[model samples]
Target: MRFKSLKGIQDILPPETYIWQHLEHTSRKVFEKYGYKEIRLPIIESSDVFTRSIGETTDIVEKEMYTFPDKGNRSITLRPEGTAPFVRAFVQHHLYNEPSPQKYYYMGPMFRYERPQAYRYRQFYQIGTEALGTEDPKLDIEVISMLANILKKIGLKKFTTEITSIGCKECRPHYKTALKKALKNKLNDFCEDCNRRYEFNPLRLLDCKVPSCVKARTVAPAIIDFLCAQCTHHFETIKHNLELLNISYVVNPNLVRGLDYYTRTAFEVTSEALGSQKAVAAGGRYDRLVKDFGGPPTPGIGFAIGIERIIPLIKKSIVHDVYPDLFICSLGREASDRGFIMTEQLRNRGLWVEMNYDELSLRSQMRKADRIKAKNVIVLGEDELKKGKILIKDMQNKKETEVALETEEILKAVSNKK
Candidate 1:
């Protein structure tokens, strides 16, 4: 019998995984610097959480989520995104009790049953962050600044951000009414999806890509125009703060994010490397979500970057030249044991070390070290054991050095260069 992975799901193997690890590693570095601790949530959650929070009218809840019933007939679904589950945990743990504004980051796979495309899949990975309990527009600027730094750090050169203000609860109704009125006669001209959108979720009219729908969106009302004084001030202050931070952005009226929870501020970052489906990351403020989820009113904002999309755009060749600090080449029985011991000691000291073992001749052992591009190669043979010394060769310089069998002696020499 033959079996394969389900369609739209692909395995991440070596060379490719090298890039994934690099992105995750660098995310930790940048996120931690911005004071975001990592959070891990269950991959599955109660289905209503998403339907209620994401809005049943949104495509994610209405069409794309992977949901099924358990033996008890309770519906459980694989999370299609990180935010809702993150909030569920926040509410479950009552995180507000610990701090006023808590920031957390996460990296994991997300599931969606949408048609797969370049840099998108039914199952994909995402690196996301959530800053809870703060409504200051300054936090918006900080989050944007953090994303820019992360993008730069990962060597993503072909990307830009588009920012906008989506009217809040106090303001969105005006825009929605105006947008619907503007589309009254043109409702039939919209795509089939937007036809339903007009009746169910008129705000999503701007999200459609069908030519007629897109053209209709061109005439649609802008949320920014309807922002109430408070929302307007919040949006304006964030823009000013962004300018003060020297972060550039484009004002996109049609950039209302796909999520129903977003309010006041919305933004998307796109990459040229990934053609028309260009957004690599997107997020906005959702001040009403905490209360929507049964918690006291709390303001929050965050973003999620598609690993599949970002990896394709990153110039990973420049990320880092990974190599073992040392490679141990052992030829005899006694030498193998000692080499094994030396390997552990070097690793404990935070040095990446590789050793040649099994089915490898001395010549082949050397090749293995070169294959890994180890900086230094230690030759442990019978003669060297009797001599109470080992030979260390620097592959790059083709230089040789000798030291006593004591591990510290080798550590001293290696630590100096590293």
Candidate 2:
């Protein structure tokens, strides 16, 4: 029987894996620089974690989450997003007690049961950060700018940053009422999803991309107009500080995050190069979630960058090639055994070393080394082993340097040449 990978799932193979590593390393560097620590969360959690946090009326809980009952007859789910589980950990561990604003970042797979499109998958990876315990708008600006800096360092161009204030508990109800009143008559013209969203989640109706829904919501009231005095000030502060940082952004009135936990400032970074699945990263503030999850009142903001979405764009901007620093070609069994020991020594000494274990002919081994783009090649045989001397060939320079067969001498030759 021939089995294959499940649908909507993908294997991230190399040189692509190299690109993923590059992205991970770059993100870690940037995140650490901004005083955010890494937090590793599980891929599975109690189903309520998402349903309670993402909202029962939202599309994620209504349709996209992967949920099932465990053997204990308790419902379990593959995490559809990162924030809820992070909040659970935060509350359960009382990380809130540590400092005024506790900042953390996470990177892992997120499961969603939607129809996979280009750059969209059932099991996708996300790099996200959450800063808890403050409602300061400066934190919002810093988060958005940090996201821009990561993309900049990763060599991504041709993207736009969009932001909005969805209003807090103090004023969102008024905006929702006005929106429903405006869209009531036109609800029949919207798609079925939009129609359902209208009754249960009017804010999401504005988020619908269906052409008719999009056109209809244009006539609906903008949430910005309904911002209460406090929310208004918060929005203005975010805008003013972002300008000071020179981070360009557009205030998108219709940009309501898909999650229900979000309140106040919301933002998304999108690339036109990714058609339709344009959002590469998005997030917002969730001021009430900690209290809702049975913890003390706390405020939080975060964003998640889709790894699958940014990889193609990053590839266009950067080419990551993996090559062995040294390839040792062995022509005989005795030479092969010795080459194996040499390879380990060089690797232990902090060099990328490879060797042909299969006792292939000299020409075949050389071909293999060349195919892997090894920087240097050493041909070891009975003659060289007996003579106690070998030649290291520089693949790029096409030059050869003679060195004693001792590991220290080979190390010196390679180190000096490099």
Candidate 3:
């Protein structure tokens, strides 16, 4: 019998894992620059966190979430998205009590039950950030510009920023009424999902990607037009501030968050290289969520970058392959034992070192070292061990420097060369 990974799940192997690390490292630098701290949250939460925050009417709650009952009969779910869980944590921990706008960033896998395709998976990863307790329009612009900076730093040169305001509670009712009236006659032309969304969450109708639904929504009312005075000014300020940062964006009236909690200033950054899965990162404001979760009145905004979606579009020029700094090739049992100690010593000094345990010939071990592209190599055998000295071979220049066999000597040799 054989066991294999479940469907829609993948093992991120070498070279690829290097890219993931690179993306995370680069993202952390940019996030820290914007005064956002890292927050680690659990992968599972009470099902209500999402149902209430993301909306029971949306596809995620109705069709996609990995939900089930635990042994305690409590309904639990693997988080389908980041914001809901984040808000739940904020309220539960009283993070709101500490500051006006607590900023946090998180990176980890997110689970969903959707069918796997190109970049879509049942188990995927996201890099997300949330700014809680503030609704200043300037913060919105800064968040959007920060996303643009991350993409730019990651070498994603071609991406479009689509911004929109999904008017807050005061203005959404009027737009929902207008949108429904415009699409009512053509309900028959829309997909089944859109029809359901029309009655429950009409804003989602504009978000449908089905050909017929897309066509039917052409006449639907734009949410921006219905923005209340406050929301209108908020949206306008986002645009103007973005310009001040020299960031380009498009006001996409059709853009709307699938979640119910989002209020005002929604945006997405997309790349044409992704085809149908175009959005690499997206987020919006959710001002009422903290209060709804039993915390004090607070506002929040955030975005999640689908790591899988962005990985494919990352330019090859920026990603680098990881290789060992030193390969210790051992010939015999005694030499292998010595090489093992030396390898650990080098690694403890913050060097990437590799070695083969099998009693392969010197020629074979050297070949393996070359194949791994080690920066330097050291051969360990009876002859070198007896003399208490070894040759450090520089792989690139093929220069050999003889050094004492002691760990400190080898450490100094590599550290100096590096």
Candidate 4:
């Protein structure tokens, strides 16, 4: 029997990894500029952590979570999303006690049992940020601005920012009641998932992708209209700040995120390139999350971008041309041994160098170097080893020169351009 990788998983091989590296590098730079410190969390956590935070009625908790019984018979699950675990970490480590507003950024794989498609996968990666302990609308504006800048930096031209206000604890009940009344009679025409969501989270029905649900909810009540006094002001303030920064956005009535904790301001950076699954990044205010996770009544907001979805968009939009700095070519046994030492020395100087250790022929080594597109080739053969010298060949200009293996000579030879 031939074993194969399970469905909805992908292998990121060589050339494809260049895109991942670029994305990570750009994310770090942008996140750092916003004063977000990096935080790493465990991939697995208590099942209740997600059930309580992401909401038990959500698909992630209901049918998609990868849960199992560990050795102690404790329920553990691979994280399906990024925010809940970070919230757990924030409370467990007492980060909320020391700081008024703690900002953290993270990037890693999240697992969910779902159907795979072009960009959707069961196991995928996300880059996100969390800001804790601030109800100020400015923080919301900052997060949205930072996400927009990141998309611009990555060269996503066909994207737009959609913002909405999902009301706070004060006004959501009224909105929920109105929504249920509107859909109560038409529930039979909705999908089973939408029918279940109606009682648990009517707002989620707006996010349903089913064509029938979309048509049914087309005239459904929007949460923005029911915002309480405070929520309405906060939402208006977020919009004012965004306009102050000249950040363009469209107010989306149905942009309630998938999670239950979100309140007030919600936003998504969507791309036109990916058809129905066009949301490259989405997040919003989760003011009650910290308190729900056992921390103080702190306000927090964040956004998470799907790395898999963003990478393909970047590849289609950005141009990256990276090549090795030098290639070490070994001709014979003795030369191969010395070449290994020389390779280490070059690497120690903060240069990218490559060489085969299995003692392939000089022609084969040169071919490999060419394949990797190394700029310079350093040939070490029996003759050059006997003479205590090496041949430096510039791959671009096809120029060659012999230099002594002395420290100064080797450094100058490698550093000099052809």
Name the candidate that leads on TM-score: 2
Model 2 Cα lDDT, one tens digit per residue, 226-345: 999999999999999999889999988888788899999999999999999999999999999999999999999999999999999988666776578899999778888899999999
Which residue segments of model 4 deviate by more than 4 Å? 183-196, 209-215, 317-320, 330-333, 356-362, 382-390
> Using alpha carbons, what is the TM-score of model 2?
0.95
- lDDT, model 3, position 119: 92
By TM-score rank, best first, the candidates go: 2, 3, 4, 1
TM-score to true structure, per model = 0.91, 0.95, 0.93, 0.91
Q: Candidates' lDDT values, in order?
A: 0.88, 0.91, 0.90, 0.87
- Candidate 1's displacement at residue 253, Å, is 0.7
Residues 1-418 of candidate 4 have per-residue lDDT tens digits of 5977789988888677878888888889998998899999999999999999998777788899999999999999999989999999998999988666789999999999998888899999999899988898889999999999988887777789999999988899999999999888899879998887787778888988799888988779888889998998999998998999999999999887777888888899888888777889999999899899888888999989998888777786555667777788887788788878878887787677788878787788899999989988888877887889777788989898888876457667777662
Considering summed lDDT, which 10 consecutive residues are worst modelled in model 1? Answer: 312-321
Instruction: Give me the overall lDDT of model 1.
Output: 0.88
Candidate 1 lDDT by residue in tens digits, 191-242:
8878876876787788777887888677787788889999899999989988
In model 1, the Cα lDDT at residue 66 comes to 97
Which is the better candidate, 1 or 2, if ranked by TM-score?
2
Off-target runs (Cα >4 Å) in candidate 2 are 185-192
Candidate 1 runs further than 4 Å off: 317-320, 332-352
Highest-lDDT candidate: 2
Each model's backbone clash number: 0, 0, 0, 0
